[model samples]
Target: MMDHTDQTTVLTHAGVMAMLAAAIAEAEATGQPQCIVIVDGSGELLGEVRMTGAKYLSRKSARSKARTAASIGAPTTAIPDAVRAPIGAATGGEMTALPGGLPIKVGGVLLRGIGVGSGSGDQDVAVGLAALRAIRAATEF
Candidate 1:
């Protein structure tokens, strides 16, 4: 038997930086600045970036979005409207019902979550998606 042993994949600094770069690039192409947050599977921050001209307060929401995505292994928007408020209150707003958060998976392993804020929901999601795409090449074996 394996005797209570397990394995896990984690995000690296380089991977986090690559994702940040992708998010920033997407934001630029869309003519919007954003605050992007990256978290590990356990909802711990690995990296974050607040682009110039982004709303400063958006960083808080971005962090919540990233944590929500990592904790649920799904987009933060997946939280049902009825439960969203309760969940947020229960967790002291650690979770959010935003559309900008995405689970970061590579080769079937859920390694991280990325969240973008300070733009429209669609724009935030686009930036998050671009970040995910950029990390695939860097993280996938």
Candidate 2:
């Protein structure tokens, strides 16, 4: 049986804005234009930003990446190929198997996801991780 009334931690609008700022800062520091997307635990879009000069296609890719991470409750890179292939197919490519999407968790509970695009995988992952670190620092006492 599932408890529909169970309390869950969710990303606040301010928190999502903070994440976007952090990610943009990181991308700027690296001289890489990026598109960043934030999504709730249920895969709903919370916030998004497309940096100046970022690829137009990145907007959609970033959203899919965020949705993938939130839907699976894990970093996109950590999804095993065995599962990734099927989910990617099932979702008609709505899910991405890329390295730049990260699940945001607090106290072992998934809260949201952050995804970065319009850069190399490493660059995207770096920006996403920096945003996660910023969120944790802001929220922790």
Candidate 3:
């Protein structure tokens, strides 16, 4: 039996909107067309965006970041490639082998969510990070 108390809250629609806007703003500023995704603490989809001219694969890549963050409760980037490489393969067709996903938290309790952008791996990660910053400043949790 799973304990509900241990489960993390999912990001709401409003939360998703905020996250997407921040990521979009950042990606636009960088002049890098990309995709962005925000997931709940539990790794559920909260929000997602694919920029104009972004590659078709950006959507799946963004979702992969969200899943990684939610599942580990940490920035997906923090995980070593060795661990991620296998997990990516283990998931078979579902997992995306890409960078640019992060998990949001507050004091030990997971409240915030993660974001992922589609671009170069580094650029995608940067956009996601910026969204996290925006959420932290604008929301209570």
Candidate 4:
């Protein structure tokens, strides 16, 4: 291995905007204004949105969900139920067990994470999926 690491792929500003746009559209289509958050694989925030009528506190939860997905490379729901509370407490609630968070994987490379809130879990998941589909068309790892 080299002494230093090689450069890694990152989502561009345009890409993040595309994902956010898609997520917002999905939320509107479902008639649930939502708070959506996206994070890079390193758990750095990229983009976010709080649509009209969305729950104020849901933004925090959405960020937690995005960070959770980025940290774990899986949906927030993947956290084992037995350890969910412990993990949340350990992380100071930085991670979540809700169903809205999903990893943005393309051709097996985890690139980003998205979380949507202020709606039912299913609706949130739907919004996240829409975001993923945006980048899916542009890149596959």
Candidate 5:
């Protein structure tokens, strides 16, 4: 159902970096300082940035955002925590049911990742989406 080349295209550090930068810029423009995180397919940090005035707890929230996206391989907001119960229980609390995290995908395969926080959940998700959109617009992979 999936191909190895597709997987490779989606997980590159460059791709992840681009997405994170775009997300951070978008968040900064909103006047609500935020923290942005990018992780690899395995949930390892690829990139991270915190904007001015971002709250202290935003760092942890950003991590949770990335974890949620990486675990589910989708936008974190797309799958709320209520729907993550069974999966979270099985994963031993690794999965999250929150906003501001997103998985980078290419050709339907997950590559790098995204996470945003320090503002409202909706703002966080919005910033993450802006990053994804930039990625999608920049290149096919």
Candidate 6:
């Protein structure tokens, strides 16, 4: 029998929406059209939004970035190109080495990942980080 003793914490739908709102607000503040994606720990998409005037390709890129971060349990930017290139190829380009992807965690337990695209890497990262901060501010975990 498999032991099921370990407990896992996941983000609620409300939490995901809160993050999205914050990300969108950040993008608006900077006058940046952006695409944002949120994924659960299993790399399943939880929520997504593409702001007005965002590039068409940004939707897919944001999803890929979120999935990559969730799969690796780290920020996508932290993955070296040496490691990311092959993985990107192996995954049929479902992964991205973008800097806007961040893993969402609480007390060492990963909850999800948030990714932003259609802006400069720095701007995307700022939006993603803002989302994480919003979640932290709204919830205890």
Cα lDDT tens digits, model 1, 41-111, are 88888999999999999999999999888888788899888999999999998999988999887767777
Could you tell me every candidate's TM-score relative to the true structure? 0.91, 0.88, 0.79, 0.91, 0.77, 0.91
Candidate 4 local lDDT, residue 71: 85
Residue 120, model 4, lDDT: 96
Instruction: Give the TM-score ranking, best first.
Output: 1, 4, 6, 2, 3, 5
Clash pairs, candidate 5, are: 10-111, 81-97
Q: In model 1, which regions exceed 4 Å deviation?
A: 137-141
Best by lDDT: 4
Local accuracy of candidate 5 as per-residue lDDT tens digits, 62-121: 877787787777776677546677766776756666677877777766666678888988
> Which order, best to worst by lDDT?
4, 1, 6, 2, 5, 3
List model 4 lDDT by residue over 1-141, tens digit each.
Answer: 557865567689999999999999999999999999988888888999999999999999999999999889889999999999999999998998999999887666787888899999999999998888888864442
Instruction: For candidate 6, list the clashing residue pairs, or say none.
Output: none
**Candidate 5: worst-modelled 10 consecutive residues by lDDT:** 3-12
Clashing pairs in 1: none
Question: Each candidate: RMSD to true structure?
Answer: 2.2, 3.0, 3.9, 2.1, 3.8, 2.5
**What does candidate 2's lDDT look like per residue over 108-136, in tens digits?**
77778878999999999999988897777
TM-score of 6: 0.91
For model 4, name the residue pairs that clash: none
* 3 against 5, candidate with superior lDDT: 5
**CA lDDT, every model vs. true structure:** 0.88, 0.85, 0.69, 0.89, 0.75, 0.87
Q: By the lDDT metric, which is better: model 4 or model 6?
A: 4
Off by over 4 Å in 3: 1-10, 93-97, 111-113, 138-141
- Which has the higher TM-score value, candidate number 1 or candidate number 3? 1
